[model samples]
Target: MEAYVVATACTKFEKKPNQTFKGLTEEVYLDLLREAELENGDLIGQAWFGNCGMGTFGQRNIRGQVCFTPLVNKKLFPERVGIINVEGGCATGSMAFHGAWKDVVSGIEDVSLAIGVEKIFQPDRPDMIQEIYDGGIDQFDKDEWIKFYKDVGDQLGKPFNPEEKKGTIFMNTYGLQALWHMKKFGTTQKQIALAASKNHFHGSLNEKAQYQFKVSVEDVLNDREISYPLTRSMCAPIGDGAAAALICSKKGLKLFTKEVQDRAIKIKSSVLTGGKYRTLDEPGLSRIAAQKAFKQADIIQKDIDILEIHDATSFCEIYQLEMLGFCDDGKGGQFVEEGKTSLDGELPVNLSGGLVSKGHPVGATGLSMVHELSVQLKGEGAKRQSKRHKYALAENGGGVIGFEEAACSVIILQSPF
Candidate 1:
């Protein structure tokens, strides 16, 4: 009754102001069925839908039913299939995937679908994007985070000023985190830029990436500054897109052709964990989630052949490298700066351009990571394919707590082909 990802599909991550919610959902829905080689949606027993903006856009309750009922009415999807809504800040997609994996592993469903769709681009109302991001942090107790940042600033001898900060508050938080890492680990701004430049190059090779052009380290360093030591190129862009995956049990796999069965990617383990207020010395939630996932998968860090992380900011890529045990506590910067994490390196990271270049549509971001890993494992990555493909890992975190993400999900996948 183990779960396996039989098929995955992702639309180009970009800003689509003219696209309606129904159109966006339908696009990925049909693509998922097509890729899974299903004659109709009736084969799916249950579904988990990930989305984070419908409530902000005015639809609150039953967001999944509201957006999906139209397809069912059109006879494109099944009316009897139950749909579960999921929202976990940026980790929304990961959470949905976790839900479906459990559904199959528990023998409750033979075939389940996990879909993540989002629309956060609004040219008419620029503030809407900010509002969407602001919700990632605690709203009722906003002052808690503000005070936390202020106290950290004093300890680092770099006082913080909210009024003077540019970009989103999350950017400022990342900027401050970068400064702390620099002070403690001798990490340089150039190393952060190197990660950005590398991802930009990887993005250039991916046709579905939002920023499909390569950028140099020098150019990334000189790009418009969002927060000190963090440029625009180092941060994720605003976008809209949808991604879907069909997770099926061993019995369910019999329904697909031999071609799909040959390309199936086994779900080794999937772990979801929460965050809490912790001091600077403590490890973040991603590390905790990763340990549980690694144990469940019965594999160590070195067993991983490739990876995709939630690099919301280039600095996060560095921090997560250390937290995820890819390297020592403070050597993430050095690891990337030395080209050990490039496409040709020992452990190829973020082959999808990551959030920085791939475009992060919060709800869809996590599944997009899943989509990339599945493609590479199946040896279908095309220009971005890695030489190694036995095992792959994805680390996705979302929102913000005192000093880390409010939620995180670590998924380990193994290639059966």
Candidate 2:
């Protein structure tokens, strides 16, 4: 609780086919400096870098150095600044922020930096973009996910396509899960489309979002299906971006001027956990992580004024809503239907559009979520700013294990003022 995200920034989440991962990271750093009013990068004590698809491009081994070399050299920072490259499937950015938070909370460093960057779109080698599906699994066992999808197809009496390597397997699983939820709880496609419709409206307000155009629930339902019932408009697009946050201790906040301190958002609780195997009727890791975070923050879900969840698909939005206790079991669709998660609603969720509309570049998503929360809490969200920004939560998940996320992080933030 001693650490606070005093400053945060991110590049526009979109397809920058010509940009390198390193270049995107530098842009975020520059934005971070401008936001924090810090003239020198040397003030940073340590850095945690997050990236998910470095292997697809190059430099898989020395990823830390490959991304932040001469650009963040000794001239602007420490002679031997510690840098750690991290991969947490999609929650990579939040993992880096967690690492830096520990550094500051432990009183080992004054100012620590966490940055998550990823380049998933390659104009020439479009096939390489499929790495988003492969990056989470064991590279040694490449056929594992494919076989699962093939089995799913067989179960449904549908043919499997090995050449169907365009999108992420996450969607395939999400689609399957959506079917199960609909059957078990009588969830309708209209309910899921409502969530998508709300986010599309949110996206229209976010210039950084990949798809900024608004669509009606009917439009989302009628759109081309990615995996039946899950329309293309309901899924997150592949893109490239970087997001950064500066974590500082209470004493470190003194190092900044009063204006920055006033704008700081306190980290009340942060919980990260790996996946736990579960049956169809059991709880998943994401739900467990959220319970832990809520207990740590000493607040219930009703206290959250704003939320940004990893909505890879419209179903994911509903699923996570229930898992995170925003609504009763099998009632997430109703929650969205009632407009409880809109800007004018009591708890505005995903005001920055979220992954489905804002674009998901894997490693950068979690921190981008945090960046949105920071801006809202600081009353700097401009037109999209919610009147209720006192308490916020961000839930980001990565990879998959059976029916659970391989890794998940839940963070709660409180306005310092």
Candidate 3:
């Protein structure tokens, strides 16, 4: 049984409240349930929650129950709603949505709620980086992880390059890959700068985006370089945001109003995949997930009109275009140069500015992607609306162990009848 997203909501990361995690989560849930026309009492099944900075804010394993119970009547629906928490680095939001999708498809629940919330505004930047790097792993060996960076640098013939080491430390790993693409395909720094500039331009039209000012390619290239070949403009800014989606099976779908039913988007497919541990040279999980989604949706590459992908850096968007079968391998840089992925190009990608300008709030990023795509499908993206959109794809990845995604999830969405 295919699942459909009946309602969704996302709060701009920039407007975050200076409250506790529990407080913020309660607000998000209330907004979501109200928007979906779902009373707190109506959610009688399982609840899947995801957050990245819960521990940083002093909330631990019971974060899910604590945040959700306040918005719903726990006394009346205690046993009916089971709470489950998931953490997959940057892909926590997608993981939560995937979990709920599984339960609904398997007939385990008639209705399921997927919510992702995170707050990372702290006093110290290094402390926050360290906390994100550790990310629930038991064998937290910093030296071992640093050595892995050295190994990656060695393989790339850039031994003794401190940028590579630093890249591995902070999601700048895409910089190393970007350098490889530049060396092999003559991909100029200007091309990457163009991608960043376009994202910022798109973000300027999105009210929910963090950085809403337009930037030039020259501005991006001239900006401070976090890692060589990856300017500050290419990196995702730290922020707080929460997104929620209410999904229901066909039987439960009838409860919604005709207006809600008219705007619903069908979940054509949801695919989660991973790669060989500790290696970055292989095909990305996005490729694996897209293949499965396309097969399930009975669509080809050309059938997709719009896409929301994990562009944590300019290089990530380049490589993901190829991995997701939008272009040939090793030619993603060329594809971007040719304007194939632009809003007016053959396939418009990252229509929501992606993580680059939309703000990568870790746990909320994936669901945020879904929220944007669904709006586009419903003709509600407003100024950033696509010219023609029938099917859309959301590709989100999380963490970096050695080279591949520690976890990744992809979902294909289309207008529901």
* Number of backbone collisions per candidate: 0, 0, 4
Ranking by lDDT: 1, 2, 3
lDDT of 3 by residue, 20-137 (tens): 6766676677677677766553654788899887876677788788787665554433454788998888889999999888888999987888889888766556576457656733
What TM-score would each prediction reach against the true structure?
0.98, 0.95, 0.92
The lDDT per prediction is: 0.91, 0.85, 0.78
Q: Arrange candidates, best TM-score first.
A: 1, 2, 3
Among all candidates shown, the one with the greatest lDDT: 1
Candidate 1: count of backbone clashes, pairs at least 3 residues apart or interchain: 0
Which regions of candidate 3 fall more than 4 Å away from where they truly are? 15-17, 73-80, 124-126, 136-144, 155-168, 277-281
> Where does candidate 2 clash, by residue pair?
none
Where is model 1 poorest over a 10-residue stretch in terms of lDDT? 157-166
The top-ranked prediction according to TM-score is 1
Judged by whole-model lDDT over C-alpha atoms, candidate 2 comes out at 0.85
